[model samples]
Target: MTCTIFYTTAMPNDRAQVSGTAPRKPMRWAVEYLIKTPDGRTLVESTKTIQRATFEELRAIMDHIIGAIGDEAGNIASFVSWRATARGGRSKRRARR
Candidate 1:
């Protein structure tokens, strides 16, 4: 199975993917998500979340958000992603008995 991320600038009344579909929300909250690839590029899987949204009213709204998050990282804040590849790959090793 596969899943996708939805980005919203407006405070999410809730995380419900679509109002009529998916489980409803208990309380509305301001929430947004930004997904970047290990290469520091925005992933292309984002196009899949536009199923029921209106073209004009709904905007991706993440280009600016990405820059903001990067800036926040420079400021050194928690949950702030400075770079996707901050933790590089580890050296391969064999298990020992």
Candidate 2:
């Protein structure tokens, strides 16, 4: 089996607003990962958000996750399905509110 892993970082916009009167918190960044099969099918895709101060920590975490997934091909589908179920649950809860 062949696969490719892609990573990207997203920076927060300058005009973001917070809900309270307190000063806005430091910028938080998002690290996104995309795992794709040889035929261009996406196996797993997810993003992890972290404060700027923890950028290096987030990078390390991303590297670990990528390494583990690369070492275990069989777990890709399971990860994707689990994410789907979790996402569905969140959406259902939002819809009920």
Each candidate: RMSD: 17.1, 13.5
Using TM-score as the measure, which candidate wins?
2
Q: Which residue ranges in model 2 land beyond 4 Å of their true spot? A: 1-31, 47-53, 74-97
For 25-58, candidate 2 gives per-residue lDDT tens digits of 3234444555655455675454554444232343
Where does model 1 exceed 4 Å of error?
Answer: 1-31, 34-60, 75-97
Cα-lDDT of candidate 1: 0.32
Positional deviation of 29 in candidate 2, in angstroms?
6.7
CA lDDT of each prediction against the hidden true structure: 0.32, 0.38
Clashing pairs in 1: 13-28
Tell me the number of clashing residue pairs for each predicted model: 1, 0
As a whole number from 0 to 100, the lDDT of residue 43 in candidate 2 is: 54
10 residues in a row with least lDDT, candidate 1: 80-89
- TM-score per prediction, in order, is 0.22, 0.36
